[model samples]
Target: MSIIVLPQAFAYPAAAVVSTFWLTAYQMINVSIARKAAKIVYPQMYAEKAQAEASKEAFKFNCAQRAHQNTLEWLPQIIASTLIVGLKYPIPAAALCGLWTASRFLYTFGYTSGGPGKRSLLGNTAINAIVQLGFILGGSTYTVYQLLA
Candidate 1:
């Protein structure tokens, strides 16, 4: 039996799946925590009918925060995935994608917990940079490989 190497395009769908999982998981966790925090902070605020309306506003704030965080986390994945498709370097691309996902998880935890701002941002940014570099290198390598072959 002979094994065949699949083309780089195959990585696109896999990367999408991974990206979706990471983004969705992070957003869900953020929203969950935000909701819980709101409830804790405004316990009596939601007691009466008018008060419920006011309390709902707090929940909305949490939702907005979750959306903001989700958007920030998604930018790197979008860039990385595009590069993976263009470059067709599956192995390194996939590895970087995994690292990006992990870093986002750590970032979400750090951000929600009010960890040191510099440390959290630095860690997340480093991972984002690594993913970006992989994409650039992968594209260059693919270009060379295609030219040679």
Candidate 2:
């Protein structure tokens, strides 16, 4: 069997992919700290029902958890698009991934700041994420098409 070789430029997007994991870890640590501050214990997703309804700390913890969860939802897509598109267009893929990661930071910080409404205080991070994903996905599609042709 022949060995498949990746172009050296792939390292750029590869680093971007690794950065997402670091971001994810950071979010997770935030959630852990928030959980402790809010007194949320293991096996519980959030504070007790009454605390959830009445406590700001509980809300903050929930937001931290949600931010990490949201990041996980997008992680596979982020890694896939970066690596796949990076095969042909490494620099652009890396740039898009970097922007996407930045948006996640904004999303988490804005969310964990106070309330759910505050999540958009920094900017419309969701839109930034969507736009970045669109570009990377488009590039990945083009790369696939070129490979198949």
Candidate 3:
């Protein structure tokens, strides 16, 4: 059989693909954790929300759910955009993707453990805004904008 070879340049794109997998799994796991936490805290909740007033645990559970949902709503664009960009500047795409993943993790932990108004980095709001902008800007600068051409 002939040997298949990949260039050294493939390294960063490979890493970026791994980062994408990690991030997708992280979002899914966050949802699972949220559902399990809800089950533990409120056994009455099967598929629907509990009718009683929200408690601290409930709020924490909601935080996890929202975290997963927010990522689902936004991150896919960046992930796919990064893949497109990776053809040219894989390392930069990988770095930006990794940074976003890290920020999401911190946000998830701080929101679930501390409360609604906790700071994961300088401030959760600031961190979220920065990461979102980073993806849009990074993707645009990297190569996503090329698609428009």
Most accurate candidate by TM-score: 2
The TM-score values for the models, in the order shown, are 0.53, 0.91, 0.68
Each model's lDDT: 0.55, 0.84, 0.63
Model 1 agreement with the true structure over 1-149: per-residue lDDT tens digits = 99865675756547744674666666676665565655635443223444335776444434435444655656654554645444555565556566666666665656555423622554786776665566546654565677479
Candidate 3's residue-wise lDDT over 17-98, tens digit each? 5765676687667656766755544453323355113555555566666666677787667677566666666677677667
The collision pairs in model 1 are none
The whole-model C-alpha lDDT of candidate 2 against the native structure comes to: 0.84
Q: Candidate 2: list runs displaced more than 4 Å.
A: 121-127
Candidate 2 residue-wise lDDT, 40-147, digit = tens: 999898777689788888978988998888789878878898888888889988998888888888888888988677777557576665746586567778889987
Off by over 4 Å in 3: 1-8, 40-54, 123-127, 141-149
List runs of model 1 lying over 4 Å from the truth. 1-16, 39-83, 115-122, 133-149
Instruction: Please give the lDDT score for candidate 1.
Output: 0.55
Checking candidate 2 for backbone clashes, the offending pairs are none
RMSD, candidate 1, Å: 8.0
State the weakest 10-residue window (summed lDDT) of model 3: 44-53
Candidate 1 colliding pairs, count: 0
By lDDT, the better pick of 1 and 3 is: 3
- What C-alpha lDDT, on a 0 to 100 scale, does residue 108 get in candidate 3? 67
